[model samples]
Target chain A: MMRKTRFLAVFLMAVLTACAGAGHLSNWHDESMDFGAVKTVAVMPFANLTQLQQAGGRVRDTFMSMLMATGGVYVLPPGEVARGIARAGIADPTAPSSEEVVKLCGIVKADAVITGVVKEYGEVRAGATFGNIIALDMSMLEGQSGRVVWTASAEEGGVSMKDRLLGPSGKPINDITVQALNEIINKLFK
Target chain B: MRSSTSFLNRISVFLITSLLFLPGCASVKAGPAAAGPVVGANFRVAVYPVANLSGARAPLKETRRMLTEMLRAKGMAVLSDEELETFLARHRIRYLGGLSAEESEWMKGEMAVDAVLITSFEHYDEVFPPKIALTARLVSTGIKPVILWGGSSALAGDDSEGILALGLIEDPGRLLEKAVGGLSDSLTGYLSGKEERLKGASWRAVVRRGTEETGQGPPFYFTAEAEGGRVHIGPFGPKSYYEAPFLAPGKRYSIVVAPFLNASADRDAGDIVRLQFVAQLAAIKNISVVEPGVLREKMLTSRIIMLDSVSLADADLIFEGLNADLILTGKVEDYYDYQGPNGTPHVRFSVSLIERKGGRMVWTSDSSNTGDDRVVIFDFGKIRTAQGLASRMIRVIVEELFSGPLIQERPKGVS
Candidate 1:
């Protein structure tokens, strides 16, 4: 009976941990700036703080594709953005200053600039089960004033109930990344 | 004891019957049937090397051999593979998308071939329920080469799966044979003048997910809709334009399909999309697609690179170089193929047509599609390859652009 109680306790703890890591999202929008005015935007290279080498690039690409797919705005081609960055003489493409952002927008002929950061990406373990997790933050800056109009942060994926009960059958890393990006996109439009 | 023995006998009969009908579970859907030879039995044809755009290393030699066999089976003379290779090497000709007017005339003089067959292997999946897709076009070689016929075929292992999942194909080779065989039959039918156009595009347009209602918070340029729960921009939106209102019917127009800008993560996606457009546009009866190789060569020699859209200055250069009436260019947003049993292919791109004379934008279109767009129940109509899906999508776009008002016999008295 004592051993049975211990097993149940461990099982309960695992479930609780998974529930805690489910998903999170936070966003802030400035009503003063009209998002409709922003017809074209440039997505700069995302900053990667995680251990994964290409996590930043991967997440940024997904965000751009998903955002463009939304049909809400026209996302400039990466090659054109690169050329704009070079012409603008921006030393840091990943994290651009407000002045540099304005310069880039001018050269690319975009109304806005979008920057992103990949904080956490890859597998995370909760109890005995392992699953994919992706956490990211994104911001939109106006072209003329170079002021941030919208900001959002999102985290998705983790060990689920099914995963804890039955071995690891969680979603793939790509799916996790997409889910996280989708959450942030929803917040942007919201 | 007698009753028990009777039960055993009944069970045995049931088991034996099932074993007999097991093989019947697998089914085959024959493509367009082959008609009699209409290209005269003495016509000599050369099959070029199979273009691999599937993003996976395919069995090129084997596929060519099968195509050649199918062509010969229809009572047409096909140049040997070795001889074709030797000719290609001797001429140092690598571009296989389409032959130029000069090259076509030269081929008529040297090789004496009446037509050339260009084939592209778009998708070849080796996993369970193996899927294969390919496109073939026959262009005549003379003073000016014209696309005689074009056909595409795609097959998935579970396409014909009946109840109980009995008809699952595990062998990729069998799937390839069926796909190739169907294409051959379709080509033969077209050659015999029995099948004019293989099959019109019947797939529905990419739909927007209901969950993503255009956000009311901000005034946006166009309503955004997610096709298959994935974001897909304009073309279906309110401002999307179908055909070039300025296009004249029954008039042959020279077109140049420029390389698209790749916005997706996939490598060479722009090139792949460009070739697809070239192949389809060439098959249009009223349009003459310029040789892609010649255009690429000119672009290289002139050192012209398009940053985003084609500018007027660059347009003039293209006009002066090739006398092209319209320049077709766009950006490929996404071109991806999922793996495994439940994976689906996705493709998205937008195109624009620019007239060279005044350098004005005449037409623009956006397309997004998934393999499972129209698939319903038991995956009966699922497209398993990105190439198959893209071809279907492009076919619809092209047909809709040229159909109805654009190409209708300019009203009896209005011309």
Candidate 2:
């Protein structure tokens, strides 16, 4: 009887532990919009709000690379996007207005556009423990209508209990970045 | 018989001794012919003070001393620093970025200088993986100073890393020497009628993203070579339609590079990029890039200030002042260098070539890069400095701008 009780306790704890690394994810999808119609997509430079200098561009390039790897969508070249931004006279590429989005999409001939913001990137510490973290929020807009068809957010990496007790063995920033972006990408496709 | 044997032995000893000393005599005679400058035949080059456009403090004295020594080593008669100083002081010449027409005449008549070399120092970093960027142009010292030769380059310690980083350069002094040595070699090559040509190489990293319906295979193609490893998987073609047709075969054109606009955080990034482009453009045999100092002087005298993009009227004014066939200008979006172990340099910029006759953009290109862009593994192809990255980027863009079939029809307007 004691063994059974212990087994149940351990199994319950295991399930909870697995759920810890899931991070925070909030997603919105428009049921009225047809996602199948979207083909080529353009990713604008992400807006960075952290102390990290190029956290925005770095994350955007990684997310673009991962998205391109999935073979689910065609991502326009960054140079093409830059050319569109230049021609459209978009002052701020990170946070373009709906009208600018339509014009940029037309210029690049992209079916959709994705813009993102990096809230937190780099090592975060809670006194005794330290760990890498990345917080990313993205929105996909319909090229023709310039309306948000889908939006998603994801955060990954933090000080775990093992880390606190065993001391911090921080992961490479790139790995944490890939994890965060992968989670968001899965959510987008799902 | 014994006397005859003694005579033969003496003759044998004398012949061996003579042969041993003959090579030493020959080498002593060959030294000047092979390496030293020929008296009265060498070009008398006067290297001016380095123009600082880096927006930061540079080791100008040290750099100039090294460059002058290197130029002299290449069998050119470099003017002594003392003489150069005396002349500048006498003429009260504060600006050394370029020589004006009057100054050129003075140099030819009074100094008997055959050519004047103007240099611009762009970026110098003494951190790990030491880096240096500079451009030099040799112009004829006459009433009309025409650029006879020019070269711009950047060097970093970790640029040519081999297995386990065996080839990485860690000394800033060695790196500087290599950078200066390359320019001297190029100048000597030109003087000897052997123009250096760049081998064909593609700098673009294409990533092909095939849709699910196409049923394409893998997402990337990886190739590991002996020099530097590269991984590319993407659609093959031009990234954008930014370029317009440029250049006619067998025709030479003169070009003026206007100051670039800096949107990047780095100070004077615009000027750094402008000088880099000028350096690359001047090296082409068919194109003559005006000395940037000349252009700067003209702009100052004409009271022309370009707030943003160069206006049509401004272009006309520049054309009138320089009488050049084309005007090259652009903006630098990002020029950043990361520090520490995982650092990588990133640079992004765009350029456009405008026709003086019709005021149309004849060629345009946009380039962005990072040090770790295409490294498959082991960081073989990583770049460590923004200057080095910019040099590679500009070379590729210039090659595309000048090479290829001539397009007779006027390109459609950029939308």
Task: Quote each prediction's TM-score.
Answer: 0.63, 0.57
DockQ value of candidate 2: 0.12
lDDT of 1 at B137: 71
Q: Relative to the true structure, how large is the alpha-carbon lDDT of every model?
A: 0.69, 0.69
Query: Which CAPRI quality tier does the interface of model 2 achieve?
Result: incorrect
A1-190 per-residue lDDT for model 2 (tens digits) = 9999999999988965763344788999999988888878989989999998868866776666456545467666555577788789999999888999999999978899999999999998867788888998999999998999899998888766677668877676666776777778777878
The local lDDT score (0 to 100) that residue B324 gets in candidate 2 is: 86
In candidate 1 chain B, where is summed lDDT lowest over 10 consecutive residues? B202-211
Model 2 lDDT per residue over B1-415, tens place: 9999999999999987765554333210000001112235457999998888766778888778888998887778988888888888989999888888778888888888988888887778777867777777778787778777767667666666544555567887877777777777767666766664332111111111221224443222211111011112121111221332344445567888888878788887887778777767766656777877678888888888775546556677889988888988877868986644468887877666778765655544445667776677877667666776777677666655653211122123411
What residue pairs clash in candidate 1, if any at all? A69-B231, A69-B232
- Each candidate: RMSD: 9.0, 12.3
Q: Tell me the tens digit of each residue's lDDT in model 1 across B203-246.
A: 11101111124432222112223231242221222112223234
Quality of model 2 by C-alpha lDDT: 0.69
